[model samples]
Target: MSTTPLVLLHAFPLDSRMWDGLTEPLARRARLITPDQRGLGTATLPDTGAAPSLDDAADDVLAQLDQLGIDRAVVGGCSMGGYLTMAVLRKAPERVSGLVFIDTKAGADTDEARANRLTTAERVMREGHQGWLAENMMSVLVGPTTHAERPEVLARVRELVDAQPPAGIAWALRAMADRPDSTATLRAADVPALVIMGAEDQLTPMAEATAMVDALPNATLATVQGAGHLSPLEDPESVAKTVLDWLP
Candidate 1:
């Protein structure tokens, strides 16, 4: 093993391309792998009949690492990808050296949130991924601050998201709706970890990340001002720098 310790698995509503900004700097020394979750990017979608759950999503990420022949590596993720990283840490603790949780949390959706997620998932199913891609996804991803100030970043986020499969988006949203609460699991993981969030995040919000930080014994929390849910995209340079600083 070369001992390069990290692989970046990005969140939903986007693909591995979301990690582009952070890759060059991270690639210098860390063995980094940025993979699109199942059905999101170039990766083949799951059999429609057999959708993925949080556990299955975690398995998919581990499977990606296995295919790359990385025996042990740090795992980092954002948004839904961040939630899945928690699943990976739970299901394959031995394989994870550390974790980078960006704009994500360890809790499951509340009942109302779950209902809203289902509504979104159903919309993706009915309206088609491409349609949803153009409409809803564009608005909520980057906070209004980023939307007005940094059009380039917002454009990049849309460009990357447009490449995804509709079924993948629907499946992921449904899976997230039913994900198990992993606060207990996260609290138990005694590894070095980074829990980061955007100070002005509207979706996951900074308070959620704070609760997550409170539970993880070895985790450090970092906040980016004026950014939204997608910290890696909204402020990639700063996000990447924080990640590098956190790593051994």
Candidate 2:
């Protein structure tokens, strides 16, 4: 196995801690660096008084690599993290050796979705993170199997969501709302790619995963049984095994 570093970006309204389960197993295979994107987790971005774009978030990750003295590495993400990964690929394709897109899509937000995101961002700013998580995020974060069989997983997800800063969450919502379609990027990518989605993922279902796999120049899809949007947490062992087997 190659010892190339791997950078895993977390989902929206969550932080680097989301990847905790895969850390040890993945670390044994390759160096792993998980960064809390701006305003999320421990990363504190100075208040710019404007909604940051996905390009800005992508630059932040590249800057992180520069700070760590890493020239290039495989870049991957889940959900919102996947958006950032595509942005990074657009901005600095030379720095990415491989691509791992988990439970994410290649299209831009629909107009209605963009409007919804703006509304959610405003609500978060006014009502705060906890309320937003309860009213808007909780239902879509997991799948039926997880809710029925894994209360602990749901609880952990809640804890992670609750811990995020409201400002960061709002910023992320706006960033996602404005992100561009990445289908062309995926089509052009020549590096090895792996796409993972939960069998029960509602947000980005198996069909969407299949579409992404078909777009990539070289890619494979792995479905995690009994998992949801947050597959890495809902079924960490399976996700880890798939990643370990797929990593270049």
Question: What lDDT does model 1 reach?
Answer: 0.82
Q: What is the C-alpha lDDT of each candidate?
A: 0.82, 0.90
Q: Write the per-residue lDDT of candidate 1 for residues 1-248, one digit (tens) a residue.
A: 23476878787788888888888888876888888887788877767576558788788878878898888888889998888888898898999888889988888899998998888788777877664564676676777789889999877877777777778888888889878888998888888889888887778867788888888889899988878888788888999899888886
Output the worst ten-in-a-row residue range by lDDT, candidate 2: 131-140
Kindly list the per-residue Cα lDDT of model 2 for residues 1-248, writing each as its tens digit.
Answer: 66889999999879999999999999999989999999899998667776579898898999999999999999999999999999999999999999999999999999999999999899889989684474466677888899899999888888888898898888899999999999999998899999999988888868888889999999988989888899998988899899999998
Candidates in order, TM-scores: namely 0.93, 0.97
Candidate 2: lDDT of 154?
A: 83
Residue 82's lDDT within candidate 2 is 93
Which segments of model 2 are wrong by more than 4 Å?
Answer: none
CA error at residue 183 for candidate 2, angstroms: 0.5
